[model samples]
Target: MLETIRGLLEGKPGDAPAVLAPERETLDYASLRDLCDRTVERLNALGIGRGDRVAIVLPNGPEMATAFVAMASAATTAPLNPAYREEEFAFYISDLGARALVVAEGMETPALAVARRHGARVLRLRVPAGAPAGWFELEPEEGGGAPRAARPGPAEAEDVALVLHTSGTTSRPKIVPLLHRNIVASTRHIGEALALSPADRVLNVMPLFHIHGLVAAVASSLAAGGSIFATPGFDAIRFFRWLDESRASWYTAVPTMHQAVLARAARNPEIVERRRLRLIRSSSASLPPQVMRELEATFGCPVIESYGMTEAAHQMTSNPLPPRPRKPGSVGVPAGPLVRIADPSGRFLPAGEEGEVAISGPNVTPGYESHPKANAEAFFEAEGRRWFRTGDQGRFDADGYLTITGRIKEIINRGGEKVSPLEVDNVLMEHPAVRQVVTFALPHPKLGEEVAAAVVLADGAEVNEHELRRFAAERLADFKVPRKFVFVTEIPKGATGKLQRLGLAQRLGLVE
Candidate 1:
């Protein structure tokens, strides 16, 4: 992993300009390398070394990116969102057994208070204006016994590099430990599937804290010797301007972001034409086929939808670039490793059969950290190979294209009939007035559970429960149609910005 990071620092011929930050200042290959080296030195001086756990709580920006590369160079990097509350921070800090917590200088973040409560060392990162100032800072303990020396040894392929918390949709988040081999394998596959090269320039708006941004956007780009334009967050207006000014060739984001971009495309035709993006990548959440087609038509580029999770270290599969017949609803073929669908009995189902998706490869983590129950239930041995259960239902078509139907737990059961909430949501999204839609299960006296939907209408557009239900009825069966519709300004999202289906019923007072 360190070798890959170092290799990117040595700019190859035909490489685009160094990675830029429209939000912050840009960093060339040499400068990024120096920052990584110095950060390693600082960490070592603070008694952190190989295999130690260091927790990071920062926003998405240059500091977050630099900190990730630096920590992975020496010790295990555990990056968490800065928005976590005090209780949430306390749980993760104590759970991960972190040796130290990294935060911004003078910032009163929850991690700092949680670190002090758990007796974990607190490291303040100072961000310089011109230079990378927010680089991690290590504060030595009082009466420090013998300054610990930093180990400059290379990271082994099997060494654990990152420990991430799953996006707790149904329950509390579990820690997923990813090894150096996992990172390298997954990023290499994504780079290959995207045909990334030194000539490529990626416009990365995804949050750095998630696997999608860390590996797919940053790591993959670096591995390919390509450059990235890192934005602090997704801004539709600024995104269009940067797309033109930076001349970014490609970009990656989630479905919500794609919708926002598509909304702005009509006003930004000149910029889009001038930039001529190679492809637009979507992951994390399923992208509605309607949105995919709209984005492609608006931008004049293919929208590559991918299947990924935190346990897989970002990407499991991606739609092949042009000339490969990008499927609208399909997530494309398996990219890095072997992908299969298994029935409830743990038997592998053949192609064209819908079942639980399982993956096996170097990119897939061995198991969760200190999560024996999850490990036992999620992993299974088949044909002398260990496979990780993705808990997602999917199948391969005749052409080997993968389409994820929905999550196993996210499926809504009406009476005894099984219905995919994603299927219902996708149909509702096509309504002219519907801007965003989330389908979930609501409790019913007779049916046990009934389908319910929450929708956000487009600006100045009017929609009612009667019209919405009528719209869904046209595309779905009576049982599949939502029994109740709730018009809301926004839907609730989890920490990673994914819609939480299980909690929606309870939060909306639909369950007693």
Candidate 2:
């Protein structure tokens, strides 16, 4: 695997555009590399280099994309969600022990105050007008904090490139430090899975703070000497327009964003006709098979659903491209790492058996940072390989396809009857009026946990709760059917746009 992200640009045509921002001049390979070198030199001069953490808080787009590539080369980059509140920012900044903060110049954010309270230096980046899309200059604030590095330079394969916190739906977020090897391995895995080349251009709609965006969208494309048409964020209205205008070969997004695009796709037939997409990928969440069918039917392209997490640096498994069969609901074969099903006793399970999903590979994180207890619990030795328990319940088919049943903690236990939420969601989505559905465990005094579902109806389509329950009853066993149906215009999503199935009961006020 390539040692550093900066090395991905090597051997490519220097004048070819690598970073494309909407309405701005694209950053060619030469300029992108130049910008990366300059940024690292500046960070080194500021006394921040390998082993030091710098928190990045910038809006989504080319700057966010390029900043990640630059900082990871010289220092450990921790990209934080800009949507965080002051309190959230305070905790993350303090937790990360960030040596400095990176935010766009003149952009006010709560991260500034949080960094100040922690005594971390603030480095404001300015992307001057008419410069390459990703080109920016950093200006350190007056009275910066003490420098951490004696001499700064590019990092080695063992050095941590990026540090991210887990979503922590059930427990406190765990810090995940990804080394240069892990990132490079995952980037190459993704590029290979998608068959990326210099001519392949990815239209990035995922959030920059997330591993899916950082690795799948930016790193994967750049690794293959491809271009990334970076967007500010996902906009359903503008999605088709961008696809048509950019002539993007592929785009990867969560199911929620895909549903949003589907909702508006009916009105954009011409754009769909003109847009010839080679592939459409769904990740970070399961793409309901119903939505996948519609996407394929509408666009006449294969919808590849892949499995990923921050722990694996992004891709763990992915459905192969054309000429290889793609199972509709399954996440497909392991694309990057060695994946298997493991029992509670840490024994690897055989095919057709359900258990916790475990992965061991170069891309897997060495371990969670600074948390001995978490590291002990998450990693274990099996088959002479160190496997990290994913906490996801799944099984491998005889044909080697992996079907994720549910998160171990998210499984609904109704009087000891374990229920898979994905099964229920898939059933409910079969209803013509049900556009999107999320099945969750609702608190029940007698049964401990009861199955409940929240649904977003199709546009102008009305189907009552009774009809939906009856529909599920026909397809599922009685215990697996959702008892309570909560109809909402929109389901609550996390910062990176993934639907939170574990804590959804609290978010819906169905549990205390």
Candidate 3:
């Protein structure tokens, strides 16, 4: 496997466009390589190179995409969500021990103050007005921290290329450092799973700070010598227009974004008719089977749902493209790593049994950084191969199709009767008025926890709680049915647009 970020871009046609954005000129492969070389040289001059952490805070766009590839080639790149508050920024900057903070020129963000307080240098990126998309130069902020001796070159296979914090839904976020080998392996895996080629173009709407966007949307496309149509961020209203403009062959997004696109898609009939998409991908969350069906019907493309997480770099399993059967609810077969079901005692389970999902492969990270306790709990040796427990409860069919029941932690325990939230979600989605639904555990005084659901109704749709409860009763057992139904126009989402289930009960004031 290729072991370096720089290696992912090598051997491609130099003149082919690699990065593009709405109304911006294209950045070709040759120019992109040049940018990486220059960026590495500049970082080396600034006394920051391999082994040093550089925290990046920038809005979603082509520049963020390019900066990631370039900085990873040069040093360890930690891309933070730009929407973080001052306190959040302070925690991440201090936790990462970032040597420098990279932000767009003239862009004011809380990260600036956090970096300054930590005594980390600030590097401003300048994007030339008429330059191609993703083309930029990094300059040291005035009065930046003093320069120290630097290793000064592209990172090696063993060097950490990217560091991302786990979502930390149940515990404090752990730092995950993916080596160059892990990233390259995952990149190639994604490219192969999607059957990508130089002519393939992806209209990426995922945030750059996330593993799904950084690897699946950017690295995979680039590795296949394909182009990325980078957007500022996901805007459902403008998605059709951009799709028409970019003439993109495909796009990848979370289920929430896909739902939003579907909501607005009905209004863009002409664009939908003229656009010819080869495929659509959904990941970073379990795309509800309802959304998957609607997406395939609306766009006239296969909706490929893949399973991923930060520990695995990104992709773990993906449904194969045409010629192979694509199971709607299942996340498809293992596309990148060797996946298996493991019992609580760390024993690998055979097919047709539900247990925790585990994986072992080149793309899997070595372990969580600086946390021996987490490492001990996460990684274990099994069947002569070390596997990382994915914390997801799932099972595989005899045919090798994997079905994710739900997050092990997110499964509802109503008087010890286990209820898979995903199962409840699929049942509720059958209701005509329901556009989206997230089933979670609500605190129950007697049972300890009860099943509850937060639902978003379709446009102009109306359904009383009693009616929905009745609707659920017919499809689910009494224990599996949601006792409380909270209807809202929109469900709260995380920074990267994933529908968060943990802590949702408290956020919705249903924790009593």
lDDT of 1 by residue, 160-181 (tens): 7789887776688888988877
Estimated TM-score per prediction? 0.94, 0.98, 0.98
Query: How many clashes does each candidate structure show, in the order listed?
Result: 4, 0, 0
Worst 10 residues of 1 by lDDT: 133-142
Report the poorest 10 consecutive residues by lDDT, candidate 2.
142-151
Per-residue lDDT of 76 in model 1: 84
Q: Predictions ranked by lDDT, top down?
A: 3, 2, 1
The model with the greatest lDDT is 3
Query: Please, what are the lDDT tens digits per residue for candidate 3 over residues 279-342?
Result: 9999988888888899999989999999999999999999999889999889999998999999
lDDT of 2 by residue, 153-247 (tens): 87778989999999877789989999988999999999999999999899999999999999999999999999999999999998987888678
Q: Give residue 411's error in model 3 in angstroms.
A: 0.8
Q: Rank order by TM-score, top first?
A: 3, 2, 1
